[model samples]
Target: MTQPRIVLYSALLCPFAHRARIALKASGAVYETVEIDLKNKPAWYAPNINPASKVPAISYGAPPDSDVTKPPAGTFLLPESALVVQFIASLYPQIDYKDPIIRAKASFAQLQWDNLVAGRWRKYQFEGSEQDLEPLLEGLKQFSDSVPEEILGDEYGVADIILGPFVTRLFIFANEDIGKWAPGSGPKLVSALSGPEYDKLRKLGAKLDKWPALQETIDNDILVKKFTEILKNH
Candidate 1:
């Protein structure tokens, strides 16, 4: 089958967009990226690209009478990072949910982690107070044990793609003593993950460090500095 022309609308600092970036790279899909300025989104983006005016929106497939310079009138535009990641995963057999039973299991597993684990971690990173450390610690501990060795056993799959960006950020924030990143939780989470209790999570961290696509994204010094500046201002 001929592959569709894919164009990704993305922002460098968005964690959600980072998910799409990782999936697109891992899938080995040929795609173009249109970097959007979240602060001042382009005039033509809304209603035409993504109604939500969000980054990580994708323009996919070619129209019946496709024009080389423009997406087809029938080009499919999809928004939301999770759905986009799932769509890309569904396209590539090597990294997708191949069987119905496994697909169902993976979906449920990812949903559980999203609700019970990733959501809490996000809260701790953004809105957590000093008083929130204990619960956050407990949550991280449980999450470490709960995350599968690789979201899909041996290969990086949808679950891993969805969680990879956030995990990379967590590892960065936890390890660095960024004075104001997260008052108590940041350092404490680092100490906890480094300790014997989170051996499994430490191993996962090691695996992430070695993941080529993720490492490439994480190693973008400019983007890292940009995000760090945002954190400093926060």
Candidate 2:
């Protein structure tokens, strides 16, 4: 099946948008990208593409010469990073979720990491409370343990596509000491991840960094600088 022509509304620094970028890149899809300025979004953005005015939105099936602010009738407008990734993956014939077993495994992988991420991110990454440190490490250990080898098997499928951005960001931010973490908490998190407990996740993160798609989308220096600036509530 032919995938629709996609105009991705994205911001380079956004992890959410990076998910879509990875999916699109890995799928070998031919899509145009419109980098959105998240700070001062264009006037046409919200009404034309995503009502939430967020990055990681897509304008699907619009013609090459189509007006962005007013796409022709039947143009499919989609928002949210995960959904966009899923939609793109669904179109590609190679990344199979058709088999019931694969389907179930994918669902479980996504759910497990999704729940874990939501529970731990704010406390550990952003707020970086001293008390929240151990809990976050425990959660990551659970995540690494649950990651089936088959989930991230030969092909980089939806599971990897969805989780790659966050995991990569987590590793980079932790190691670079970039975030609003309490004094010494960032280094502690970094040190803990360097230990034997996180060997699985650490290896997985390194593997992701090697992927051309992820490598292209993620610039380690840029991420460190960009996130550090953003985290400065100073």
Top TM-score model = 2
Q: Which stretches of candidate 2 lie over 4 Å from their true place?
A: 1-3, 96-99, 152-154, 182-184, 195-197
lDDT of 1: 0.72
Q: What lDDT is reached at residue 38 by model 1?
A: 97
Candidate 1 per-residue C-alpha lDDT over 160-182 given as tens digits, one digit per residue, 9 for 90 to 100 = 67767776777776666433435
lDDT tens digits, residue span 1-234, model 2: 565678888999898999998888888889888988898999989887888999899888998788766778789999999888878877775654557777676667667677776568666777777777777878787777766666554466676777788888887777677767766666677687787777767767877877888889777887787777888853
- Residue pairs of candidate 1 with colliding backbone atoms: none
lDDT of 2: 0.78
